[model samples]
Target: MSIADPAAVREHLLAAAAAGHPLTYSELLGRLGHAFTRPKMRALCVTLAAIDEAAEAAGEPELAVLVVRQSDGLPGQGWWTGSWERHRFTGEWTGPEARRLIERLQGEAYRYWQERRGG
Candidate 1:
C-alpha cells in the first residue's frame, strides 16, 4: 500500500527548506501522518525523486536535499547513488566533503524558497 502524496510531500520539504532546516526521514514520515518503516521510506524516495526532477526542470534546487538521515544529517544512499553525479560531485559520499555538498545544496534550496516567500 502506497501513501505518498507528491504535492504534500513537496510542500513539507519546501517548508523545511524555507525554514532553513533539514528534516530526518522519520520526521518527514511523521509529518505525513505515517510511521517510520522501510517500505514507506522507499515509497517516499520515489516521490522525492519525482519532486527533485520537477524542481530541476524548473531550474530550482532539489528539495530532497532537505530530507536526511537523523544519525548523520545527510541524505541516504539512494540520493548519493542517484543524484550525486548530477550535481557534478566527484568524491566519496560521506565525511566532511559530502556534508559540505549537502549543506551548500540545502542552502540553495533555502534561499530560493525563502526568497519566493519574500523572506
Candidate 2:
C-alpha cells in the first residue's frame, strides 16, 4: 500500500473546488493516474482536518468549512459539520472531495495573504 502524492492530490483537489465540482473517487484516480492507492487516498482525507486547524489559527472563518466532519455516512465519506456563520452543510465526499475542498479554500486564503503582503 503506497501513499498517494499529497502535493499532487492537493493540487487536483484545489483545482476541482475552484472549478466548482465535487471531488469523486473516480475523478481522483483519473487525476492521479497510476499513482493512486486506497491507503494513500484515505490518508489524504484524514489530512484535511489539519488544513482546517491551520485555517482556524489563521483567523479565517470561511475556511472552517474544511474542518467540519460528516456525522451520518461511511467512515471515509461526509461533509462539513463545524460552525459557518449561521448555517451548516452536509454531503458525501470521497478522499478526493475532502482534499479538494480544503485546497480550494487554502488557495483563496493564500491569495488573501499575498494581497495583505502587497505582493
Candidate 3:
C-alpha cells in the first residue's frame, strides 16, 4: 500500500479511520512507501507546514485549512522555521478533512518537485 499517489494516501487515511485507528505521521509515511528517519520525517513535515502557511497567505485558504486540519496530530513546527517542533491541536479533525488536506498538499508538492526535477 505505497502511498505514492496523493489520492491513495488519502484513501489509506480514510481506511485507517474506518478501522478505528488513530492517524500518525509514521503510519501515513508507511503507506507512502518511504521510511524517513525521525529527523528526515520531521523536516518533511515542517516543509508541508510552511507550504500550507504560504498557500494560505497567498489566498489559498482552502489548501491552508486542509493542511492545518489534517496535520493535527502529525508533527510540525511551533513557528515557521527550519527547526521542527510538535504541534498539537485542540480538537480532532474528521477523516475526510485529513484526506482532503493530504491529497491537496501532496499533489501540489509533487508537482513542484516534478517541475524542479524536470528543469
What are the models' TM-scores? 0.93, 0.40, 0.33
Give the candidate order by descending lDDT.
Answer: 1, 2, 3
Ranking by TM-score: 1, 2, 3
lDDT on C-alpha atoms for all candidate structures: 0.89, 0.45, 0.42
Name the runs in model 3 displaced over 4 angstroms.
Answer: 1-4, 38-75, 78-119
User: What does candidate 1's lDDT look like per residue over 1-119, in tens digits?
Assistant: 23467889998888898788999999999998899999999999999999999998999999988999999999998888889569888888779999999999999999999999754
Model 1 residue 95 distance off true place after TM-score fit, in angstroms: 0.5
Better of 1 and 2 by TM-score: 1
Candidate 3 per-residue lDDT over residues 25-57, each given as its tens digit: 565666566674666455445544555455457
Clashing pairs in 2: 13-100, 68-81
Error of 3 at 79 (Å): 11
- How much is the lDDT of residue 106 in candidate 1? 93
lDDT tens digits, residues 1-119, model 2? 11234445555544544454334554455556644466645565555445445545767533323222234212243224432333332334446665565566646655654455443
Number of colliding residue pairs in each model: 0, 2, 1
